[model samples]
Target: MRLQDLFINEDLSIKDAIRKLDETAKKILLVTEDKKLKGIITDGDIRRWILKNGDLNQSVSLVMNTSPKFVYEKDVIHAKEILKDKMIEAMPVLNDKEEVMDIIFWNERFSTKFNQQTLENPVVIMAGGKGTRLEPYTKIIPKPLIPIGDTPIVERIINRFNEYGCNEYYMTVNYKKNMIRAYFDDMEKSYSVDYVEEDKPLGTAGSLYLLKDQLKETFFVSNCDILIEGNYSDMMKYHKENNNKITLISSLVHYTVPYGVIVIDEDGSVKEMKEKPEYDYLVNTGMYILEPECLKDVPEDTFFHITDLINKYIDEGEKIGVYPVSESAWLDMGQFKEMENMMEKLGVK
Candidate 1:
């Protein structure tokens, strides 16, 4: 990766920093002034800031880790050790003048393997929906079979879970399921996938009842059309550490209004007017890590959405957490535009 790509001005807005992070996909950024590191901001920092409900319009300087770990170029011998010890993604090497000389990434210096941390959790993929967004494409093949680059979207989702050592997958399929099953059966894979057929159309989380008895441990539930690119192991660790019964994954998404928005009082008095105001929201990414016991909450043979279950937990005052990922980390293939965007994000033609 280019060092220049990781450098950002400290005065940049936090929302824009998010854009930069997603743009680079390096998972880290160095806030610099004249090549001297002012501070550093990684995905973790942004996630924490977002969790605390920090202001998005504020400058990066407000959210950056002012005291970031770094090493002098002359004393680069322990850079790798420092990176490993700190559990950070990259190490910045500074010269005697205290300017950025080079950057050493964990994968470049330390890892001789990939996804060393193994997780045995089963993954439940919701592939039943007819992707009406890509109308012409879905008319022939199912959404799961829709290609993002060369690989099908569902396969890509499975491949991501595979990295976390997930071997067993339960796919809930309905529309053109035979084609999906045939595609998987034709392809050679290391993991196993059992098809969970829904005789009738079940809303998002309704078909999950089929696996109530089968999945007895903590498992991941994902939509077939999305690929979330982040550390699944870390997310799982967060789930276990927080003692969360259900953890829904989310992304920090923002939208800016093109024109000035006005808010008027009931008496027709203007109360507020802001030009091009931006709004930041923690949007659910349609991926979740839920305990098996939660499956009991799913109504039998009834149309239900995952939100219904989450609401039930909320009504019961049960602990339900939402894990946040960067805007760049989540990729969706739901729409025609997003399909092209997903391909671009994955660097496919």
Candidate 2:
């Protein structure tokens, strides 16, 4: 990997810094000025910044870690020890003049990350909805079986989880359930996918009631149409450490208004005028890490959506948690345009 690819200007906007992080897919960026390492920023830094509702337009220097761990050129052999001791993915090598000479990546196999993570947690996928968004195509085939490249979107989602050693899967099935079952049954797989038959269209959380007796531990629940790229083990760690009843795996989505907007008072006077503004939100990625006990709250056999469950917890003064990922880390395929964009993003035909 090119060390230059991970370099970013210290004054770059947080919004653009996220873009650079996504472009490099390195989970980190080196903040440099005149080839001198000024600081370092990671996706974790950006997530924390967004949580505080910090302006995305703010410079990355505000969120970067100024005293980042590094190794000097003469101590190149110690780079491994520093990286290992700090548990960081990479370390910058500095010359006598404090110039960034190169970067030493802890994970030499850069094709993937967290090779040491092994998750025993089971995954539950909500795949029973009648996907009306895909239009005429859904009239014939199920959304879970809808192909992106040569593989279905659901398979891509599973493939991602599979990398972390999650082998057991439970899928809630209703519409075109047989097709979904047949496809996986006939194909070769390393993991086991069990079916949780939904007699009707059980809104997201309703079908989960069926798994109450089986899932005695913390498990993953995901919608059928989206994919997220991140460290699942780290997310699991956050979930357990926080003792959260439910953790929403949200993405920081940036929505830009196309036209100039005007803010008006009730008297019809323009209060404020601004150019096209971009809004950043922690959007629900239709995925969650849930404790099994939360399933008891789901109304039995009713069309209870996940939002209803989350709202119930909120109303009872229960604290829910959110794990935010970068905008590019989330790939959603709910609508036609989103499906096309996801395909394009994945470089799939």
Candidate 3:
């Protein structure tokens, strides 16, 4: 990869650096000035900064790692040694004068890849709901049938799971079910898709009751409108390790409030006043890993939402987990604005 693409000035604010990271699709960046390496920054560094309530407007220099590990281009062998022993996923390569040359990924150097594990677990996609948020478009086609680029949204989601070797899909269809079925029928693909027709509007978890017998093992349930870019293997491992009956995949969402007013006191007096501030929250991405037992709780052919299932498990003291993923790791296409933004980011137009 081009070193210049991963190079950012130390003076760039944390917020702008984040955008740079997203644009480059690299989790790490070399902080440089005058064609030299000043430091290094990674996505983890920015997440930690946010957790510590650091100002997003602060210069990246404030949080960037000054003592970065790098090797001269000629010392590739030595770099491999450091990578193996140090467990570093990526390292920067420098010229004799300590000028940034390029970045090398450990996996690339060793011809290895991560998260390529094939998963045999069945994936249940909830495509039943009429995508009310999408409006007139949903009036013509189902939300899952809505195209992001050339492929439908649900197909994109299934493809991601297919990377993990999840070849069997159980799709719950209701609104515009015929259209969805017809689209997949015409496509020639390796993965096997099985449809579960919802006689009525079975809210989220309610439709999963149909799979109670088929899903005898741990499986995945996801909303057709959302996309998570993280590793499903890691999430499944976490769920199994924690003994969670249900695992909710959540992503960090950062928002800078467009305006800010005064904080009023109990007596209606202004307690404080400040400019617009940023906030971070863990938002559910409408994806889940579920143990087979959870399916039994859903009433057959009845309207029930996933949130209701979660509440029942909570009240019963069953193990439920929320796996936190990076903001860039999730793409929510449920809303029109978000869909447009995602299309733009993916270079759809």
lDDT of each: 0.89, 0.90, 0.86
Query: Cα lDDT for residue 12, model 1?
Result: 94
* 169-198: candidate 2 lDDT, tens digit per residue: 999999999999999999999999999998
Task: State the weakest 10-residue window (summed lDDT) of model 3.
Answer: 109-118
Error of 2 at 146 (Å): 1.0
Candidates' TM-scores?
Answer: 0.93, 0.93, 0.81
> Per lDDT, what order, best first?
2, 1, 3
**Native-to-model Cα distance after best TM-score fit, residue 7 in candidate 3, in Å:** 5.1
lDDT by residue (tens digit), candidate 1, 15-126 = 8888988787777899899999889998888888887888888898888998989999878999877876787778789998889988887786765543345899999999
Stretches of candidate 1 off by over 4 Å are 9-11, 108-111, 114-116
In model 3, the clashing pairs are 119-164
Model 1 clash pairs are: none
* lDDT score for candidate 3 against the true structure: 0.86
Residue-level lDDT of model 3, residues 282-330, one tens digit each, is: 7888999999988889997788999999999999999888776677778
